[model samples]
Target: SPHIVLSTLTSYCPRSPHIMSAISKAKKSADDARDAAAQVREVLDKIRSALSHHAHDTSLLVRLEGELVAPANDVIRMKTYTETAAKFAGHLKELSEKVGERIQLHEDTPASQRTLNVAFVARTKRNASQIKAVLCQAEDTLDYLHQQALSSYAEVVLEKGARVIEERKEERKEEQNRQGKNQS
Candidate 1:
């Protein structure tokens, strides 16, 4: 009886492309997000170092602004990946829930029938557990990406604000120099 149940479960457990595809896509997205985050970090570091040494250099600020564009684009890409991952996680959660319901139904059957379905229910439970694990991983990845994007955006805004203030100060200094010359 056990052998028959094992054979039946094995035969029915054909690998589902949907699960594999979701996993592959999630992995790729996560890799991309990591790369993007790294890029953002690198750019921010460079900006920080340059600012420390050349805070009054307008040309350096311009160059840093140009450098920031790539990281900003990376952040946008990360945001997109995060959204896609969220959708994928939602779908996986639904599938997991359905599997759980199926397991419960099998368990609720009459004792004689439940005995026969024991292996099947066990396999379903295992699958459901795996789905939950993947779902949790997806959520974690989404949160990470979201935080990176927000952080990058904030840094960029602050850098731009600093640049604007520096430019204004330079303009004011020039205006004062011109006034002194005229008065002389």
Candidate 2:
């Protein structure tokens, strides 16, 4: 078969051993960089998750405060901050996968025994910088989301408190009317 013959010839071809070695080193470096970036993304995801949980807790706290005097229907409202944080985390995860896939480790890599290590180090630094940039952007987004959640929760608590005061006033008015009717 023509295809079989070509495949056999290509397999038997004597490639430069030095070039192969260089390629292997570069591949290893690229893989390491990709792994590092993935780890950084994971850490950032955890940070975002923690922030979301805090937001949830804050909302819950506001709800508890409302329970002391506010009507059941007027209790604090849970804000949408946690969901936003989750979305951001998901985006970061997708980005991490893309970065991992883009890391190309090929056979044409320079020889590891020589100055190739220096090149590898420089490339690694660049990859790290890119990862850091992505993380910074994620942090900024999460911060804004948290702030919105906090404000929403605060507003709910205030509304609940106001509703409770109005209810108390209505009760007092009804009590005064009942006493007047009894005297008549």
Candidate 3:
């Protein structure tokens, strides 16, 4: 798991729409990326067919390389991101299990058979301590997963930016060459 078996956030989570939306977005992005990869594969197959017809064509080969490499890299990054998300979900499930345990132990206990005054204080303290332990574990798990996801995204963005910069540099150089040839 990306994080540990983990801790509980609250006794009752009550299904936040924001959390659901985030999960949906993550799944959608991975699916979209997968679809993009499929399209890229089709493009490569066409490139291959074109190259087969013209064995000595540098343009087709260049197009194949340029088209395949970036998307291939992106697919790898998306795989990592999705795997990390799955780990995060596993830890969250663990947390939910812990919360359920807490509910069984405390909230469901018969109130008529309950402790009073100092005893109540002691019980609360014990419950608090147990909950705190669970929460601390959960906090660490979430923090670590957050760090990993952010790092993955940052790397993807940086790699993409690097590729774009290189492509733009090549374009500017070509434009300059074209202008020089016209001037001459």
Candidate 4:
């Protein structure tokens, strides 16, 4: 965003509006990206809250073939996805902060001290676009993880219910055999 401000002070091509237009478009993209990152943060916070509660309760869920058949495992998987999302958001946040520093550096230097270059401006725009792409990927990953978690929870619930029914059936059969022997 600072680049947007700085460019207004020094337009390399005085009559060319193309650079200004590109900067405007890139600024809008960065703003959208920042909003997307905020949404991701909200999701991660919820996941962290749920994960903390269920992580300790993993022992309560069913186990099959020595594997954890539990929603906690699903939440754990979701956490990994959230972590990747957080990483991209953090990078974007850091890059934006750099703009402030760059602005300060530009201000401290006299106009005659340095020439205005468009390459840095172009690089900043590219970084914003790249960060936006990363945020999009993060959103997609979160959605996929959410779907997997719902399916996994249902599967674990079914397995637990089935195991309970099977155990009861065995117990009842044993009782009936003992009763028959007693009656005989």
lDDT of 2 by residue, 12-105 (tens): 3334344334334433433443343344445565434433453223233233323322221111121334465455555555445434522432
Off by over 4 Å in 2: 1-42, 45-94, 105-116
Candidate with better lDDT, 1 vs 3: 1
Whole-model lDDT, model 1: 0.51
Instruction: Write one digit per residue (lDDT tens) for candidate 1, span 25-112.
Output: 4445555666665665565456445444643233453465457557546555454555644554454445346445544655556556
**Steric overlap count per candidate:** 0, 3, 1, 0
TM-score of every prediction relative to native: 0.39, 0.45, 0.44, 0.34
Residue pairs with clashing backbones, model 2: 22-109, 23-107, 23-109
Each model's lDDT comes to 0.51, 0.43, 0.46, 0.43
The stretch of ten residues in a row with the least summed lDDT in candidate 3 is 2-11
The digit string of per-residue lDDT tens for model 4 on 10-95 reads 34333434544544444454444444444555544443333334322212211110121132233333332456445444544443
Error (Å) of candidate 2 at residue 32 is 34
* Best model per lDDT: 1
Q: Per-residue error at 22 for model 4, in Å? A: 55
How far does residue 173 in candidate 4 sit from its true spot (Å)? 0.6
> TM-score ranking from best to worst?
2, 3, 1, 4
For all the candidates, what are their Cα RMSDs to the real structure? 28.7, 31.6, 26.4, 27.8
